[model samples]
Target: MKVLVLGSGAGGGCPQWNCNCAMCAAARNGSRLIRARTQSSIAVSPDGQRWVLLNASPDIGQQLRLQPALQPQHGLRDTPIKAVVLMDAQVDHATGLLSLREGPPIELYVTPCVFEDLTTGLPILSVLEHYCGVRWHMLPVAGEQRVAEFVIDGFETLRFRAIAIPGKAPPYSPHRHDPKVGDNIALEITDRRSGKRLCYAPGLAAVGPSEFEWMQGADCLLVDGTFWTDDEMITAGLGSKRAADMGHLPQCSSDGRPGMMDALDGTRAGRKLLIHINNSNPILDDDGPERAELAHRGIEVAHDGMEISL
Candidate 1:
């Protein structure tokens, strides 16, 4: 399986537009030690010609503009991308639908809940039909499907399941009680010919038993590394929210403690990498102590344009 792990940055992207932190400063000044990235997404291809984009980020147009081979040859009505799988309804992950408005009718896959969110006010299909043609396919949260030569499975996520976090209300809540909606999900892409697997969970609140088996067995694992510590934002003066409050797993530190590194232990999985990095995390700089710690653990920090084969 030839997989392209696209932009690994968190929602706002590394080197956030308004921040002036050291990492952002270094990245802006052309220091290779510090990296810049786009939003999280991926692409997979069997013959290297046909490709399916995982999520259409707001930066899709620019991402494709940078990579000509992945450029769509057809207008809004015709595209090279066979389909698009949406992990959630977050603007960062789904707003890029506008870019594909002119391309060929896209085969979009998403959980029924996410589809409801997309169709809440204006059905995506109707909107797309107004702009261009689009094909919709609702995927079952815990089911699998065959699209083209690839087999994909969708796993419901704990973070996006809309089970209100302790002491907080669910986002996009309803009236009396918060509406339970699955906000996040994980995708496992398998090559029918080679039987290799690549598991991707971009926004993780916490690891759960149900998905543990797949993570342990995946040939390549891309898990969330949004915040180095639960209090990272607090320490950085970025915000008062905890990692879990933002719907991401705290992998580095928690409650003034320091065992967050345990989450990325190399021995837990054969091939593991961290993505969806937040701007406050110092690991973006290669020379940082955090980077060294991850290197020691045999965990690679995902970078933009990085490619891997399973």
Candidate 2:
């Protein structure tokens, strides 16, 4: 199984257009320690020929331009992207679907609640229906039959299971008051042939015993690293909202409570990486103490264009 890190930054990305925060400023100045990044998204492939996008960010056009493999070749309209799997209905994760309207019909996989949210709240599907055909697949997130097996490029079969993680609905949704079973989820994908497993959860709000169990024995685990502390936004004076309120469990907590880093400190996973990083996160600075701390704990910070094979 191969995975490509298309974009590593959270919403607004590094060097956000309007902000002049330290990290963003550093990125704008071309500081080596602070690299510019786009909104979070990834591509997975069983074989190099065909790819499935994990999430399509608003920066998909730029992200695709950087990936030659996804570019057109045989014909004017040919593309390697075969499908897209959405983890949630957040704008950062789903807005790029609009950019793909010009491409050929694409399959989209998402939980039923997410499907409804996109159709009713955002109305993305309704808008896209006029431009191109979308084959929507219902992603199951509960019960013993949660795994959805599908063939990739007519050669390899991969199984994916969406595990419900603690998170609230997208802020723009009219049904935000009614959070459903699949408001947010972590995806566990396994290569049926090689048995390699990968777990991706870039919007994690909280990690409980069940969530930890879901990540056990994976070959690679990519998780949320949106904020260094719960009050990161407040401390940086970027916003009044806490990281927890934004649906991300910080790497560390200000109240001496265990955070994401502490929970994965001694995990058995062969590889653990932090993705979907926010511009305010100190870990984005290579020379920062937080980066050193993560390295010491055998964790890595993922960056755009990173490729991993398992």
Candidate 3:
């Protein structure tokens, strides 16, 4: 199994154009300790030639332009991206499908609830109809006894399953507060040939007993790290909502309760990395206490262009 970190930042990316936060300012000033990142997204391949993008982030164009592996190598219209698996219908995660409109219709695996958001509220699928059409594949949640397995064209050696994580829908959807069973999900991708597994959940909210059990004994676990504290955005003056209000679990909680870090502490996965970090998160600063804490616990912060093979 081969994994590539296309973009590692949360929505709007690091040093967001309109943001002037200290971290953003430092990133704009080209601080050596701070790295500017694109929106969150990742690609995985069982054979390196055929890749499956997890989330079509808004920065898809920029990310593709810099990654030679994702670019067309045959003539001018060929792409190695064979399929896309959407975690949710958030604009930051789904809008980038437009950037891929030039290619042939690719397979898209998404939950039924997320598909509803794309068809009604956001209507991204309706927009993609005029461009390169999408072959919709129903990605089943944990208990849909019917074939929940999604198979790609040339990547049949890899097994894909969706684990319904605890999360709500995007604000733009009608199901925002009334989320169904499949509004959001985590992917457990296993390379059957090598028995290597990867659990990916960049939009993680809460971790209960079932969620924690789902993460056990994986080769790599790439989960959410959107904020450092519950009131991160509020304290940083970046937004009016707490991390919890936005369907994200911060690394640290204000009420002295267990948080993201504590949840991950129990995971027996060989490699655990953090993804979808917000611009306001102080962990972006390499010399900050937040970064030190991650280092002390041996957890890595996902970065763009990072490649891993298992």
**Best prediction by TM-score:** 3
Q: Considering TM-score, which of the candidate structures 1 and 3 is the better prediction for this target? A: 3
> Model 3 Cα displacement at 305 (Å)?
0.8
The digit string of per-residue lDDT tens for model 1 on 227-307 reads: 888888898887899887777776675665433356556235657889888887888989989889888888888987888
- Window of ten residues with lowest summed lDDT in model 1: 156-165
C-alpha TM-score for every candidate: 0.83, 0.95, 0.96
Scored by lDDT, model 3 comes in at: 0.88
Candidate 1 off by > 4 Å = 30-32, 73-78, 121-126, 142-181, 256-261, 266-268
Q: Give the Å error, residue 144, model 3.
A: 7.0
Ordered by lDDT, highest first, the candidates read 3, 2, 1
Q: lDDT of each structure?
A: 0.67, 0.86, 0.88
Q: What is the lDDT of residue 48 in candidate 1?
A: 59
Residue 260 miss distance in model 1 (angstroms): 6.4
Model 1 per-residue lDDT at 185: 67
In model 3, the Cα lDDT at residue 5 comes to 95
**Candidate 3, TM-score vs. the true structure?**
0.96
Kindly list the per-residue Cα lDDT of model 3 for residues 120-197, writing each as its tens digit.
Answer: 999989888999998998887534532256777789899988878878799888878876778788988999999999
